[model samples]
Target: MDERVDDDITFRRLEILLAFMETGNLARAAERLGTSAVTVHRALHALETGTRCALFRNEGRNLHPTEAAQALAEVAREVLRTMAEGIRATREVAGYSADRIRIGSLYSLTSRTVPAVVTGMKIRKPELQTELVLGSNADLLQKLRDGGIDAALMAVPDAASDVESEPLFVDDIFFAAPVGSRYADLAEVDLAACANERFVSLSEGFVTYGGFLESFRVAGFSPDVVMKTDDIFSLMNLVGGGVGFTLLPGRVRGVMPQQVQLIALQPKYLMRQTIALNFLRSRERDPNLLALLAVCRMARAGLS
Candidate 1:
């Protein structure tokens, strides 16, 4: 027989051979495999034929595995184990069973929501590594759609067919001003009244920037934007140092320096942002995403 014929042995046949070897009895192996003794006997015989080598000898009503069978069984165990590991690794690379999950978010969320969610996820999955990617709301959404990140925490935008969102909380936009500004003493800011005020704002693409434009549009005139920043922290600092007044989300209230004060917009000019977790609709059932979704749900509950 050609020695290469051993390559013809299938994993299913090897499994049967290993089962028989481990249990040391045809009936016991069959019982272990949820099959009949006759089926196990036939599979063992076929395994020997496929390898073109004698692997068993009948003694009375029982069959005993030969030395060759024992050695082959050991190799088979290692092969099956390696195959299982390889499959798992492949799935992880495909993001189906990832060991690490990438999370995208707006820089503003770093203050409270992002940290809380990260801590909760780590506690729930001690082995899972979490990577936080910070960007503007539009940038984070783009990363999510491109599969550059697994999920995003941002202001929920207009719906997209490929993206699914779960709202975590709602944040009202506020007029951010320096503590000593004349508007600081007002009960609520009338944005129209601040039309001539110099403003510092997050640049285009940030959710807050969109809100800023919309709020001013509602106020019937745009404020003079003196500086536009990509970093929410820098924008807040600019406002704190009195570089200019700006429109900001409520989430930024306690995070800015004492020099910065956030006050409500007048009723007519009020705008609210719904902060949500967004991900590819297709990955909604992914295990890593499922864990994140659970953590986010708990966060929402706690906030409420």
Candidate 2:
């Protein structure tokens, strides 16, 4: 009977296995574990030797966990949870329980939505510490996946598998045209009416842009995009200049230039960009995450 239970391989091999299960690829798992594929391979070899069973099998380029590995995963998860709780308890006992909440947001939210939410949260829980990070939707999603942020406020993408999203708000998209434009006086207009008009748009990867494309698809026409800018304010400025009309969030009406007219669409192919509070489903039980979520929900209700 091998009683060498405290070997470093025991913990490290379990960590590698968990990483593999999360990513389903040796290279990605190794990257998450902060080691090379060779090290992960060696760790798996040690694990198989210690257990006297095959843990995984290579299927094409990906590694598939064997039935034994699948069974072990539940145990591994519990072990890791216990280890984490132990560390947390130790830290708490040492009077180091100042928890940190890390949050990420898209640029649009960072301007007003996130700040307002953070302010409201602080007023309610002054002792809670928080860190805010801002980036494009894709960048923020990647950061969340990498565990760099505990939660994020973003426009929910079409496909989000591992993330749990709670819809916070539905931001309506509108057309912003110059005040005196031919279509300015109309209460509503269809996209087909402006098919020949030049359109200013946000650069690729922006949620606004994504919504714009979807709206066009529903309207049965592709927009004639004449210029693309990353900044919503810049796009607004161009629309004010009569360079082109642009699709923007309803919230943007509050910041539009005096010369810009925001037209609500009729038969309203209303493209609602949904703002959601997203967090890794695996971390839903963390106290810090729960607290932040509570704060976010309160803030969202107040705003609504």
Candidate 3:
């Protein structure tokens, strides 16, 4: 037998084989496939010849498929399914490659939402490549304005005429403190309660830093900020090491150490952070941008 899996094994032949396997007769298979019985027979015969194996046996006037035919039918279904998926992906990308959906995000989301969005986008386009850029909300916005990134997932800032942004989810600001401290015992912490507590925070430029300052402003007393660092992990580590309590988004819980406890802010002081997907109006229809937007919505929707 001259076995081969080249172009000789055509999709048309596989379809006929599957139909015959289902109906168990040439005429019936032809009717199911909207083709003539002779055409179906010829396709099956060609398939058997290409595979160099006998896929059917004649018993009286009836043709019964052999085990090989049944096995080939299963393989054909899988191949066709994969082919359909590839065609759909190609259509989504308009057959483009070497293009990346550059995604800029905040440090907080880098631990959770960023990864989920990237994974979701890949699932939608297996060949799609993504670049995850992490920075402060201001830095991301600058990159978006300068065309450094295709899109961004970050806290929504004031609207600009050229940038298109949509709110995806609202994450509540919380008071982050050491796990066993007195602040950790409270179900929710009021800004006034932590007024005298030493505060550790990310330096200026971070969206969370603004949130932290706002919470203090609303309480009518300024926190005695003991440390101000440019990185969130360092700030979190300081908080966890009993350096001070800090204000952070709820998503930060996924990144910081177990010794750090995040408590909700009291209703009066609770700040709602609007997470949004930002893009330039000009690139709204770009296929890669579209796919990334879809994933951002899905990931945020799941969180909501």
Locate the minimum summed-lDDT window of 10 residues in model 1: 1-10
Cα lDDT for residue 172, candidate 2? 86
Ranking by TM-score: 1, 2, 3
Score each candidate by Cα lDDT: 0.87, 0.80, 0.83
* Residue clash pairs of candidate 1: none
lDDT of 2 at 229: 85
- With candidate 3 superimposed using the best TM-score fit, by how many Å does residue 286's alpha carbon deviate from the native? 1.5
Task: Give a tens-digit lDDT track for model 1, residues 267-291.
Answer: 9888888898998888888998999
Instruction: Name the regions of candidate 1 deviating beyond 4 angstroms.
Output: 1-87
For candidate 2, the 10 contiguous residues with the lowest summed lDDT are 91-100
Could you tell which candidate, 2 or 3, scores higher by lDDT? Answer: 3
lDDT (10s digit) by residue, model 3, range 157-196: 7757787887778888888888888876788787886657
TM-score of candidate 2 versus the correct structure, residues matched by position = 0.67
Worst 10-residue lDDT window for candidate 3 reads 91-100
What local lDDT does model 1 show for residue 279? Answer: 88
TM-score of each: 0.73, 0.67, 0.66
lDDT-wise, the better of 1 and 3 is: 1
